[model samples]
Target: MSIRLTPLGRMVVPVLVLVGLIGLNGWLSATMGRGPWLDVDKVFHLAIGIVVSWVFYYLLRQKHDAVPHYGFFGAGMMLGASGWFPLVSQGLLFSALPDWDITLFGIGSHRNPAFHSALIPFFLVIGLLHYRGMRDFAIGLSVGVCSHLLVDLCQSASSHPDWYRPNFYPIVRGMYGPFAVLWMLGNALIAAGLAYGAAGRQPALVRMEREGFE
Candidate 1:
């Protein structure tokens, strides 16, 4: 699971895993319930998180040697987990991060919008991660946030009744296609933008070294 591969191979594995899992989930729902069962949201989220983390990781690694070699990596190797563990674990951990609002902040509804409303703390974490030389991990977590918000923000009030309430975020209730999709995409784009900014920044040491060279 922790094996490194050629770039093409590394990219292909996640897609394959996503496809296979989706198929398996579909099969399970078909046989177990015997009727319509489209409840593989978390699986899709997990795959999105893993795949997007890789996307950001690859982009960040292109110009920065500070980023790790994809497998058996930690923010600074402290996690010590190997293979796909680094990315996969991050994907799983951060994708569900937004849901913590339910218990921690006493939010009555699931997938509450209050989490993203607070931008100051998110910015603080970004700064701290940059200082710790873990901006790549920050990018990974951003991808997960994007994934969570993409799904949660896309649902219609008709589907998720809790969305009926007045909340911290805008509610674009629809049939889960046009308006909802566009709204979700808009939020996700901002998350992607944040990740892009993180990837574009160089570590202080790296920046100083480049200046010295120049």
Candidate 2:
């Protein structure tokens, strides 16, 4: 007895799994309330990290024709790089990187403008320009970091209205209000557009048939 999934199923399964995980997290958050181990912020960060990484994978996969074909190994490598591992690791690291100044130099608050600023991504883009080979990986890391900051900003606004400023420290300070919600929606729209564009670009079964793998 063998089971086969259609191309649509292949895509839908991962989405369904993600939704299920999110639902579980919500349930846990509601039941557990606030605790050191089950902090809402931590769970939210992990969930967003995973989802963003998955989206990044599809985005990179969309340009199948443009990039080199490493086949199964490439797919696995991308998964490991963008999925929970690098996304969560790099995302958490970059997000916290900004706070180090507080402990080390005691110059500014934890949410320093230098690290959390939107300009950070532009700098990352410049790095990619100079180092072309690391484009995909760099993009994945940047997305992770940016997404983390966006979520943190939203959380900070909702939880601590007094300190809801979104700008980097000492530069300009203003409330984010509902901008984070809009930003999340924008991210979803971008992911959907990428997936729609890549939908039938190169079905694996078709490739298998052509390559005599079936």
Please give the lDDT score at residue 136 for candidate 2. 38
| Cα lDDT computed for each candidate against the true fold | 0.49, 0.45
lDDT string, candidate 2, 113-193, tens digits: 454443443454445432323433334444545445555555455456644245322221232434444444354344333
For model 1, the superposed segments whose C-alpha errors exceed 4 Å read 1-17, 28-44, 68-95, 105-107, 116-122, 133-136, 151-180, 203-205, 209-214
Q: Per-residue lDDT for 1-214 in model 1, tens only?
A: 5876898887787778756755775566466533222334444555556656666677677776565324322231111111123223223222255554544655455434445422422563367543434555555555666755654553344346554344523443322334444555665677667766655655654566567742
| Model number with the top lDDT | 1
User: What TM value does model 2 have?
Assistant: 0.48
Candidate 2 residue runs with Cα over 4 Å from true position: 1-7, 30-40, 65-114, 132-136, 149-173, 179-214
